[model samples]
Target: MKTNRGGGDEALKFSSFFFMPERPRDYLVLFIRFSVIACLVVSVSLVLRATFLSSSPRDYSTTYGLRFTTVPQKSIALSPTGSIGPLNVSHILFCIAGAAETWIDRSQYTSLWWRNSTTRGFVWLDKPVNLPQNHSDVRFSIPIRVSDPGWTRFKFSSSRAAVRIARIIWDSYRLNLPDVRWFVMGDDDTVFFTENLVKVLSKYDHEQMWYIGGNSESVEQDVMHAYDMAFGGGGFAISHPLAARLANAMDGCLQRYFYFYGSDQRIAACVSEIGVPFTEERGFHQLDIKGDPYVYLSAHPLTPLVSLHHLVYLDPMFPNKNPIESLQNLMKPYSLDQNRILQQINCHEGKRQWSISISWGYSIQIYSYFLTAKELTTPLQTFKTWRSSSDGPFVFNTRSLPPDPCQRPVTYFMDGAEDVRFYGTKTRYSVADKNFGLCENNTEHSELTKVKRILVTSMKMDPEYWNKAPRRQCCEVMEGGRGKRKENEMLIRIRKCKSSERI
Candidate 1:
């Protein structure tokens, strides 16, 4: 089922502000985390955006020369009642790729949103599926075909992509009909944010000859042969004109590069030869970045976050993908605000001052702050009362009163007064310096208590409100209880509390 791992052309050479390793697969995790901060041959000023807000139509026309007659917008909002807002999401046609074995894992998460007809769908498989009599809708299924009977047979490695993937390009292109303006293609495990996908596509004209794709292996994949071949796994869009042209030219192109092994790179070759360049959108992630994508997807930057690739190896998208409880009940009212999430969104390292990364998975670290975090271990019998100190009794509560586990912000309670100053260009940025999230004292409640509460936010609670949140209270336990603390790894083992009341 994991066959057709794609490949890229004569590796796109570069001499700019960015550097991608020749063997990216080996170091994808390190590359994704550090690349954003370290490898910038020419770091283009990142256009910081707030979540849920739409940006003005971006003009990629001059660079890629891919614009056409008209470009619509993709920012739609849901009204107060949770119904459809101004934007109609059905404009997208989702083309999902997977073998018979992986189809369930890939399509089930997205199935939550696929019932809507305006947003049509198709599952591209190696062979036709036999649907149950009770489930007789053929609208979401497409069996790929190749004149060569053996074209679809390939291993789950990148070496065979060039030859096997031509069938996908053609099969996907065949679905580029007039009814839908955009055609999006992705592997089985890809999740499409219909709302964001629409928002992104609306920026470009559907009639134009455009290949709305993402990075192959570097920043600004727009360089020469790199021309932004859609990373097929993260999901890519094709305007009708561009898709039609690709489908029309696919046969001859396939014959020309018959021995090529990477499907995506080969497609890029065809598109490059035909003159439709790929325009990258940051939101479409194409790699198995950090293991837990909860934070990445939950509070992504202001850009319309579109897709997350390689979910087969991580925890469920949400432990409770669909929580029975309402989000309003579990989350703060402000969780609905799009601007705050985008505005406070940041990533940094605590090299100089000390920073703490709230992590859920190998790479899915959430909040990165200048504050240093220390584990405060105390014996239940030996400890008497809680008092404020440079040290903290921050409680990691898998029990009561905490929002979502992912929502927990790494915090440090200073002795007398802690003034936060965000500097150091690479690892930190202050609120005054154009960034999202608030790094200030917790004054919302009666903070003048036994212990003071300072809130460090990543704007993650809102999305997790509806699902199961980690009720584990650490900082909140100390702040909510009595506290004493210190810095960095002290590594003193304290026995786990057998009962809540050991005082």
Candidate 2:
């Protein structure tokens, strides 16, 4: 009975050992598993927090709206050359009226308005002043001028003008109850294309970029060359921060320098000093006496933005004759009176024998062509083909003179072989016979032979054939085989010769 009881107790002890954990090792294993799971959960939480929850904040105070305004000098008298005689007032009035119309049209897209002060008998003030209400984003600020006679000098004029415009711009910002992103300074004669300007500005939203009117070129100090900086009086735009900087800069300058070259140069110098760079756009161009004026026009067909100091009036009589007149004639189709406008500007009665000189590239040979036709005629019928020596010149076999007395004399030289190389002597033509000398003692003959040899070699004829080939035949061969192997071989030989000579 004792042995059987002992066996049952042993069996019970063995079963308990199998079912329960009795060692420290087992507890340590369980603790390590729970610790690893807890560590993984903590690491995942930290990663999510860093990636999705904790990010740098964004700025919300930056301005987005843009405003445009014109700054006209009312206190200062017009330049001596600015006079249009009896039509001075009429011209100024017409410019103001045209500007007003453009402003009204542009106001549809953004805030467009005139920024000027009251002056004595200024025709610009006489125009209808109605600010558009539809553009909630746009507003106008026409500040009253506080006349100060002492502020009439070049430096003072620019500084004071900047201050006044800046104040008006700031006031507009306050009244409109919105943050203004950009402020554009333009001329009264400028016709703004608000849509295009807006499209261009949208590209550089956060970047503080200045869009200067006209082409900007680096000029030397001593040279009295045409100003290449952004003409503030013509058209230019400044970012919100830049506008503030400019205003502050101007104010600082007003307290110091009393002599500078007006507002445009002053602004240019000031901005340059501050290390603020400008981005140029063709949207703003100076109305000039050269180039295609219509290409510079912001509002196509009729109105051009920012007619500089020169192109204030359109000459009616010589509409297509001169720069200003040509611009007027080009805009005639869009003007109110087609024929009467020209007559009003004295287009029909003018008999002035104006000298017209046509320039061919960088050459000095100015071909003078006169027109006896009625003034304002485009003279499309009298058009002359532009010839260049590099472009293989104009070939005129017949020695017929042009109808106009002012036309330059073009003497046609012929090669009896009918393989003549026609060149325009117009560029290098000398009016003085003394400048040209006849071939003396066969010096030109040697040169002619050398040129002929070069021509034969360039034509890539066999060495034997080139030695005996006629000049006309060589020329004929070259003309026929333009893009052939002969042309390439000739080019290669020329390059090799030049390189060898250099070496």
Q: Which portions of model 2 miss their true places by more than 4 Å?
A: 1-163, 166-182, 198-211, 215-226, 239-241, 257-262, 277-283, 288-312, 315-503
lDDT accuracy of residue 122 in candidate 2:
19
> Best candidate per lDDT, number?
1
The lDDT values for all models are 0.42, 0.32
RMSD in angstroms, all models? 28.5, 20.8
- What's each prediction's TM-score? 0.46, 0.34
Candidate 1 wrong stretches, greater than 4 Å:
1-88, 131-165, 172-176, 216-227, 290-301, 315-503
- Model 1, 223-298: lDDT tens per residue? 4234446777778887766666676666666667655555666677888887877788867766433233333333
Q: TM-score of model 1 relative to the true fold?
A: 0.46
